[model samples]
Target: MKVAFTAPMKPLDHPVPSGDRTMGRLIVRALELAGHKVEVASTFRSWRAEGGEDVTREVKKLALTHAQEISEQWIERGDVPDVFLTYHLYHKAPDWIGPYLCAKFNIPYVVVEASRAPKRQSGNWALGFNAADAALAQADQVVALTNSDAQCLSQVLSKDVLTVLPPFLEEARFEISQSVTKGSADGTIRLLCAGMMRAGDKQFSYMVLAAALKQIADLPWRLTIAGDGPARAEIEPLFDRKRTEFIGLIPWQEMPRLYRSHEIFVWPAIREAFGFVFLEAQSCGLPVVGGRVFGVPDIVEEGTSGLLSDEGDASALAQNLMSLIKNPHKRENMAAAAVENIRKNHSLEAGARGLDKVLHAALERHQFKRKAHGGR
Candidate 1:
């Protein structure tokens, strides 16, 4: 099978990539691994801030122009891919030509990691949201990254069925050729947090963690935050007077190494579809401390891997942090368990196999639907 894939949220080359970009790349590789060819039809959107608010319009125009080119290619190319797979269509960046081109080419149209946030039902985001809804509804198969996302899609679209394929580990994360320990016996506890500081991000949560850890400022523990974002300026000050250190954005190549330097990984976000970083941390032999809600529970097993506190319960979060800090033996056991858990459940090869099953099912359904229509 040959597949044409796309995503409007961010390009594969975006500076600080998200889970969608990671998943998109993984799926393309997975299809290729399954003896299929994939051409990434995704293009445009550097997302640079050249002239403030005008940049949004520029990104949209570029996306639409690229979509037109892709449409033309689908028409002229003698052999269209056996399938058209789209990923991460948001209200901000809707897919305009996907449904039309895929339908015209008589190919299986499958969407992965698509969600409908109906809050943007009016005004500026409405058009893109509507486009996303239409494209998703027209798809022969829809894949939701988590059960929460599937519920959201069900609330808005009258789709036949949606499949759930959660975030899986990247290939690099599976190489446990060496052992990594959390921290030393001298009372120093190293906690790490790495992610974007976007609009709905947890830049403030890291800040709050820093504040709570202030009670143990005299202890040998350190707070090292990775990654930079627009909200960093606002939250950086909050970590200033404490033992927190901001290391800025590290290259993806260096993430596993950085993960090994820390004992406990902490980032309490409000809600996430599924945090790939949590798995990344676990893969690097670091147990996590995060919020109890959202799709996080799917990744973090309480007590074994790490602890999850109620959202906004700063007191409980601090307590959890102190628990690991106070008990080095527990931290060692948790670290070993985290790496073992990720290796067993979330390896890239395992993830690829899971997605292959979904993609093949969608392909079979497309063939079945085509045969039924032709018979009539």
Candidate 2:
């Protein structure tokens, strides 16, 4: 099937390196891995960061123009997409092209990582949120990455339209990286945390981590912080600079080694939507410690692959850190379990298999429905 792939939040080829972009590319790769011919439908982004009526109006106009452009190009080339697939649909950014083009072309429309908040229908992002809701409503299948999102989507979309896809990693590279042992059981416990130093919840998570580390000041550990962003000045000061080593921003290829070199991966995920880092770290055989809220539990198996603390509780985070620091055997056991968990559930092959099932089902259902409608 020819899959028309697009993400309104950010294009797959967007220069900025973010979890959203990473997942978008990963989803594309998974489609290809499943033996599908995928095409980049558009790089146009319909993001409304600071909501306003004028901004919404301008974006809607731009979206319509882009949709027409794609339609014209497809007609000229005589190559219309068999199915329209979109990734990441939220109030801040929503699908404007796929939904329109799919409706016109009578192709199956599918969404990955789509979240709907009906309350936003009258807010600043009212236009974008409604646009997203309409897209999901038209969608033949919606692939959810977390149980929280799945539960919410179930209320709006039919059960057959929802498919749960867990966070995953391209494990071949990580497998090789993990094979080369880096960190050791030498008295020093190497703790690593990596995420862009952004304001809001990200910075809040950093502050909580700093406070947690401060609580365990007496513990034998060397902290490595890997990330850089606009909020660095505010975030770095919260930590004891002398005790923490900053790696600034790192290249994607180097992340596997970084995770392997660290004995533990610690991050107080403040309102995270299932962080890919947790899975990446665990895939490299490092035990993780994060907040026990939202999608954290979906990735990190408590007392198994890693541990979780109560949300926003730095003291609880500190205790979990201390427990891992004090017990080497437990940490090693969790590390083993973490790697196994990734191998069993979060591998690229697993993601590709899951994606194939949903995509194939969508195509089949679309054909069945079309036939039922007298081949319309």
- C-alpha TM-scores of all predictions: 0.87, 0.97
Which number leads on lDDT?
Answer: 2
Residue 105: error of model 1 in Å?
0.4
lDDT of 2 by residue, 280-307 (tens): 9998899999999777899899999999
Question: What overall lDDT goes with each candidate model?
Answer: 0.74, 0.88
Q: Which candidate leads in TM-score?
A: 2
Clashes of each: 0, 0
Alpha-carbon runs more than 4 Å astray in model 2:
177-186
**Model 1 spans with C-alpha error above 4 angstroms:** 45-65, 156-160, 171-181, 197-200, 215-220, 240-242
lDDT value, candidate 1, whole model: 0.74
Task: Summarize candidate 1's per-residue lDDT along 71-114 as a digit string, tens digits.
Answer: 77766876677788877766666666567567767777888788
Candidate 2 lowest-lDDT run of ten: 175-184
